[model samples]
Target: MNTNTNTNAIAAARQAHSTRCRQRVLTALEQAAHSGDEITVSAIARRARVDRSFLYRHRDLHAAVLVKAAEPATASTGGPSASRPSLIADLANAHDRITRLSHENTQLRQRLSEHLGEQAWRESGLCPPDDIDRLQRRVTELEQHTAEQRRQLAERDDELDATRATNRELMTRLNRPHPDGA
Candidate 1:
């Protein structure tokens, strides 16, 4: 690779590492605090496997870390929380709605896929071939929508990489002097 290409690749790798490190640190701090470890400087340092001084140096992040850790988990499928019954109720209602839709779709598709040119099929009073074709088209549209969602998810991942790169650059600049002495 050319020097410029190599340099750019190294910079991108460094930024990715920096972002991963930050996220891992936050996750570790959350788990530690949630599991009843003190969110104090020494406690975090111990949990992070870093020195006490290093933990103190990043004390500003402590409160945010603790707050996020202390908040209840956002997703619950009837786990032991005060509001779990309500969540369960809501889930049950959603399940019923899904079941109804699924049954309706199945019936419609059954009527659709019948033999189009058969006289017996005609007498069976199935949905017209055009309606079946429309339903098939709708299914294709739904599949395309799912593909678009996956593409969007991949794009978001790329953005995360870029954000991580920018953060690494900022941190590096913070720790280094300008080429021209300031």
Candidate 2:
């Protein structure tokens, strides 16, 4: 009998929690609608301070958010106008595109980190792609500077060789017999 009573009490508490979460989600939707904010699952979840998974799991709240999201926007002073539907559609399309792009970005980042290898990143303390790109640019700049220095050094060596040859020729001429038999 005690076990039965405890089970009943636990069930009641879970039900109450579910009810409260649903109410919060609904209230968040209403507030978003009134404020002309974009009606999205994430926005509602954030406003309600509820987990998004909860919103997705609650069928009623999920349907409500979707319906609200599909509604046309209206001016604060005016009711819904004829042109508002198209504007709302456009907004929904943009939101969907943003969501898709965000997912893609996440996937790309994951792939990049995987390709770069976890051990390499840990050992080098470099973030994927960005750090690699920076290092590549630095290496290229250093290579160019090194090539320039090498060319300058070669030029200086050539000049020194020519000067030394000229000096030796002058010394030889001075040591040689003059045309006047000096």
Please name the candidate that would achieve the greatest TM-score relative to the true structure. 2
Residue pairs whose backbone atoms clash in candidate 1: none
- Local distance difference test values of all predictions, in order: 0.69, 0.87
lDDT of 1 at 103: 100
What lDDT does candidate 2 reach at residue 107? 100
Q: How does each model score on TM-score?
A: 0.29, 0.44
TM-score of 2: 0.44
| Residues 86-154 of candidate 2: C-alpha lDDT, one tens digit per residue | 776889999999999999999999999897797687679664665777898999999999999999999
C-alpha lDDT of residue 65 in model 1: 59
Query: For this target, which candidate reaches the highest lDDT against the unseen true structure?
Result: 2
List per-candidate RMSD values in Å.
43.7, 20.7
